[model samples]
Target: MTKVQTAKDVIEQTKFFHRKLADFYDNLSDNVEKERVKILLEYMSRHHENLAAILDDYESEISERVLDTWFMFVNKKCDLSPFFSASINPDMTAQQVIEIAVDFDQCLLDTYEGILQNEISDEVRDVFRGLLEMEKNEKIKLAKNALKIDSM
Candidate 1:
């Protein structure tokens, strides 16, 4: 039998995803040869960490009724390997790192959009909508920062 997931469960899973991305970037930063790439990787690492923390705060502030709402459509196991397995190398330029970072954010944005498309309750929809909006804003911020890094 498939296991049902609550909104809280989804939020927790997303938090874990961000943490894993942060670790990936952190590890890459240590191995990268280019100083600029290293700096961008470190920044990406912190960005993911901050996103996870924001999720924690979001989860805490949400009503239990919304948190406990079951997502019957979200039972499939979340596979994050695609994000980790992207063609990233220590020799990648700052622009390359930024591209990867933006791609990762886009993947996350797609996930939220996918979830929001399901026929969930309004409260649950609202919760995901909020997350989706946050991700969109962060992606723009990351792109702007990438431009700044490129100019350096």
Candidate 2:
């Protein structure tokens, strides 16, 4: 049976997801030969790490009632396996890395959107809505910064 998850559970899982993405970028940065790609990977790694930290703070501030609000219908979609298993190599270009980063961000955006679709209390909904907005803004910022990096 699929596990029913609370808002806290989802937040924790997403925090872990960001940390894993950061680690993935860090590991790739170490092996890449191109300076531009390494710089982009390092930037992406820091972005994810920052995002995870923000989530950690968010989790600490949210009330237990909202955090404990369970969602029976929301399907878990935070799987990072495909990203981890993808055939990313040390020879990839900065553009290629940005594309992968965008894809990863899109996956996270979709996950939040999916969670927001289920019936939820207003407080829980507001929490997710805030998270969704943050994800959207971050994705846009990432794209813009990555483009500047690629142009250099």
Candidate 3:
């Protein structure tokens, strides 16, 4: 790896915070109905896996700070949207679940891109950016299905 300067310190700290951010979403996998959020949650887990890898390479302080700040950041920023709540109700259509999943995936992708910009390593950033692109493609693929179901 190229010699990272002060940027390494900040990148490591950001990775730490993001790891917990990734972890919180990991926890959400168990929170809802089957076929509702499971696939989206799985996609989220991939990003968290990346974050965890970064964490493993970082020093103690950055890791610790990320663990500490994750909770508050999630509480304030995460959104369920009208799309997601519909998935939980029995009367709602299957298309709603697709919509929710697409949005959920998009949110995860957005965060990945944000983190990529702050990353010190091009290797790390490329991994995250690739994942973000994957998320977007998945979201698009799911969107057509969602609209198809709505028409039924």
Candidate 4:
């Protein structure tokens, strides 16, 4: 991946990644046979869509002043290429699907955490913090929902 430079660049990259995630979930929903699992995947897909939109709004609201400020890119393995290549078979259990989703969330959270470790302007830090919080909340929600689905 190309080296990220500014706060806006990071946000733009994240937004692109998130849109890809939304697409992944949508594809999973399409491939899954179980109605409940399908619904869950669709909900997650929508959640990712909302996340991308949120970042887009942030990018817009963050003035060029902060957006253009240089921020060091922390080299971390944040690629979702493995997920993109994953085969979503209809026979997979809801638990298995949830496991994959949770892993993906964790990977995202880790990436944001890595970003936080880097030197950045206060404005950029705040943006990253908000993104981190959102990821955390999403992970918790995913766990809870996964539990409900597992019990079904």
Candidate 5:
């Protein structure tokens, strides 16, 4: 995606990130042999799709003034370097995949948190605060599901 300058740009970037992550999980599911891991990856892939849909809703409903407002670029820059540098193979265990997925969720949550800390308007804060809550709740749900999977 292009540079993150406005609120709408950030939403677009986040949507792009979710879509790419879903694709990654889908690819991993196809390459893996374990049925359980495949199912989990598929679930995660669907989860990302849901996130992207939420962003779409936000993009449509966001106030014009807020959408045009510029935001900080430091945290808006999503670095998937750690994820990209690693070697993901068919041999990778389900637990390892779960761990990675959890990390990805945490990173998204952290991004929203960083934005909240920056000096933005109340309108922007309210929008991001809602997103932050959703992210936080999703992380917890994912962790619970991961634990169940780990026990299997």
Candidate 6:
């Protein structure tokens, strides 16, 4: 509640970190790796439920341009995966690629928490909190299905 950072600042941080996470996934080269990234992306897409809540809380006076930018950031981040590179093609072992992705995901989650924990807004914080926890859970989910992905 310190009112140090503006809601705009909170919005921007979340936006920046979200894209970074997508780009991080988009950087992987191997086939298995891409699948891992894809899985993460799909997991993220499931987040619409939480994100809608935050978006609803934005000021009525805010311009659609701001919302558009934020939405694009979300869309890009949730859908990104580096495995699209025709060269990389995701061939690594499931265990290996997912581990790397998880590290970056953790960083993404931490950045989100750091920015969101501030007094910016509970609406914003709630979404970040869900994302942070989901990133942690994703590692486990991938691990559980490692063999399935590896065989593919």
TM-score versus the correct structure, for each prediction: 0.87, 0.91, 0.44, 0.86, 0.87, 0.40
Highest-TM-score candidate: 2
Cα lDDT of candidate 5 equals 0.80
For candidate 4, the TM-score is: 0.86
- Ranking 3 against 6 by lDDT, winner: 3
Please give the CA lDDT of all the candidate structures.
0.82, 0.86, 0.49, 0.78, 0.80, 0.47
lDDT of 4 at 19: 90
lDDT of 5 by residue, 1-152 (tens): 22347877767878988898899898888988877788788888898899899889877898899989987745655556646864677777788888787767777877887778888999999988988898788778877876676567
Runs in model 1 deviating more than 4 A are 1-4, 74-82
State the lDDT of candidate 3 residue by residue for 1-152, as single tens digits. 12223433434544554465455445555555654454554455565567557445543434333333321111124354633333354243444445555555555665555555553355445544655675576557556654554454
Better of 3 and 6 by TM-score: 3
What would you estimate as the lDDT of candidate 6? 0.47
In candidate 3, list every pair of residues with a backbone clash: 16-66, 17-66
Best by lDDT: 2
Which digits, one per residue and each the tens of the lDDT, describe model 1 over residues 1-152?
24468889889988998899899899888888988778888888998899999999999999999998987653334444547586766688988777677767776777777788788999899999999999999888878887787678
In candidate 2, stretches whose alpha carbon ends up further than 4 angstroms from where it belongs are 1-3, 76-82
The true-versus-predicted C-alpha distance at residue 149 of model 1, in Å, is: 1.0
Give the root-mean-square deviation of each candidate in angstroms. Answer: 2.7, 1.9, 9.7, 2.1, 2.7, 9.0
lDDT tens per residue, model 2, 16-95? 98999999999989989999889888999999999999999999999999999988654546555547686677788998
Residue pairs clashing, model 5? none
Q: Spell out the clash pairs found in candidate 1.
A: none
lDDT of candidate 6 over 1-152, digit per residue (tens): 22343445555555555555445444443233455555643443333223434434543445544333221122113222433332344555445555555554555555555655454445555555655676567646645565455556
